[model samples]
Target: MNSVLINGITMTYDDTGGGSDSAGSVLLLVHGHPFDRTMWRPQQGAAPGHRVVTPDLRGYGGTQVVPGLTPLSTFAADLAGLLDHLGVRRAVLCGLSMGGQIVLEFHRLFPDRVAGLVLADTFAQGETEQGRKERNDRADRLLRDGMSGYAHEVLDSMVSPATVADRPEVAAHVLGMMLAAPPEGAAAALRGRAERPDYTATLPTVAVPTLVVVGSDDVFTPVADAVFLHDRIPGSRLAVIEGAGHLPNLERPAAFNDALAGLLATVRESARDGADMTES
Candidate 1:
């Protein structure tokens, strides 16, 4: 992993070496909450010929943890800074769960920087008052009891009973990520996320090719949410990985990678067509 100073924090990231003019487009993977960039290990080789860069958010993984409210906007800004540092003018942004929301926020703030979007297991609506309270309450509990109990409690729902029973290693990796997350970082993210804006309006405005993916058995943000995104984002594709839960990329890496590959092909083709027109 490489390190760079972004927004007063030493942000850490892994960049699979590739040139700017490479045939593959730059793919940026943003991790979900209570998880780090390592969650993307399965996808490191998925985008063949592309530069896949995975970064730990400000507080998670090896990145510097600032124990305070870190809004999705802040996370988005950190990404923009990282891209600028890497000399990347634009990228195909792929994110899951909370990471998905961060990608949307990044598009909202820096639309020109996004070449395409891959939103997985995430929603666009704002939190209800009750939901906000629950998130803050959960943050408090995490601060009090730490992440072990919380991670254990939600393990099944995060993945699925089938995954836990069948794919023990995948289950272990998910649990390990949750348990290893810095409680302060996770809590602060929760607090800030509770105040997140409604991105429902943002969906129809998406100009680039987009893909909305969800686990068939996801409880947090189910197939319905993915459909809503796909329906609204003009021409966006939707894929539901069967027998998987919230973290489909981990539970069904092959299927998840297939969906990403399809989207990447679309992006690459579009880029080539645009370049041809410009040259003509």
Candidate 2:
């Protein structure tokens, strides 16, 4: 429920302490549509030795939508600015869906400030034609039929049928989160995704360590997409969690935690090496 003034909007974010990290780095988690930053709680608890900051993002939760900004990259810039405000020069950025897009854009905008990146159930680049049209259509549908009508369609894509059947409340909460998003905000957010560039071509050049994680059943952004990204991103790891769909971090928390722990260990060790090289 805490707020950070970024680009004139009071963006909401929560910074929860997670164990200790003498390395002086923070882990920033960005949530996808319909949900605020709280979607990342499971991963935050799993990944210790770093401060975890989950932001509600602009137009979500208590954050306001600002006028004049492009809405999408404006989000990236806002995130970077928030880091600056927090006196964090570099940190790992973990994003899901829209959050992944934000992470991509933020890296594009502020490369130096990013220590690493985690793109979960997100495309390497930008949106495809069908995807763009579908999101736009959903936006229009939400506006026309209202949140209640569009909630299930928007929320159900994240989890598999087995999950919905076993944990009905999980599905319900996710759907509720989608239903609760401000219409104008959701519309604008969709527009931002539509206009983003594909980052696939730029993956190899990414300076920071990257992790592309997906669920075995993520039809939204399949395992193939993660593999493609992994192949292109030099050393970036590709992790797939079973028994989940798009939201692996939420659906299969333990597996997500294990994958995350592996990545963090690798990154921290590499960072130590770089630190040593600098010291010498």
Candidate 3:
């Protein structure tokens, strides 16, 4: 629940120590749209020996929300400012859903600052014209009818039907997070997302080690999307969490954490090798 003024907004973030004597590489976890940093609770202590930071993207959680259409660059700039404020020179960026898109934009803007990338349940393509219309229409609905009905409407797609039926607690938790989101902020993000650039061309240029994770049953951003990213990103690895949906990190934290641990190991080894080369 820490707050810092970054990019002219009071951004809310959680900073957990990297359990190492030296300043270790950071693991910055970004949340999806309509959800805040709390969505990353399961991953907080999971990355021991690495600084774990989870921030509520502007307009969500404890952070101040600006009115009108908020671009993804605004979110990316907030992250850059946050890292500068924290004195962190580089970090491994992990993001989910809309958060994933932000990570891509961040890399595009600050490639040298990224040690690695983990994109979960997200896509690199921009929205189609019809998709944009639907998103805007949904935004209009949120402005008019509010979040209660909209939360329930999108709850089924956010997680798997199995999660809803078998894991009542997880389903309820996701619903609660959505219902608690500020309608205006959520709508603004939806509108902003509609205008995101096509990042497909940017994937192949990613020189850092990358990991693409997706739930086996994620209808929203299907496994196909993950495969698309893995194929495009030269050396990227893909992990499919069986039986989970869009929010696999919440629905199946253990599997998600394992994949993340593997990515961290690769990034750490790469950093060590680079340092050794420099010293030699």
Best by lDDT: 1
In candidate 1, which residue pairs clash? none
The number of clashing residue pairs in model 1 is 0
Residue ranges of candidate 1 with Cα displaced over 4 Å: 17-24
TM-score of each: 0.98, 0.93, 0.97
Taken over the whole model, the C-alpha lDDT of each candidate is: 0.92, 0.79, 0.91
Instruction: Put down candidate 2 lDDT per residue, 76-105, tens digits, no spaces.
Output: 888887877877778888898888888888
Tens-digit lDDT track for model 1 on 101-186?
A: 99999999999888899999999999999999999999999999999999998999999778888899999999999999999999
CA lDDT, candidate 2, residue 246 = 83
Top of the candidates by TM-score? 1
Whole-model alpha-carbon lDDT for candidate 2: 0.79
Candidate 3's displacement at residue 198, Å, is 0.4
- Model with the higher TM-score, candidate 2 or 3: 3
Q: What is the lDDT of residue 64 in candidate 1?
A: 91
Ranking by TM-score: 1, 3, 2
Scanning candidate 2 in windows of ten residues, the lowest lDDT window is 65-74
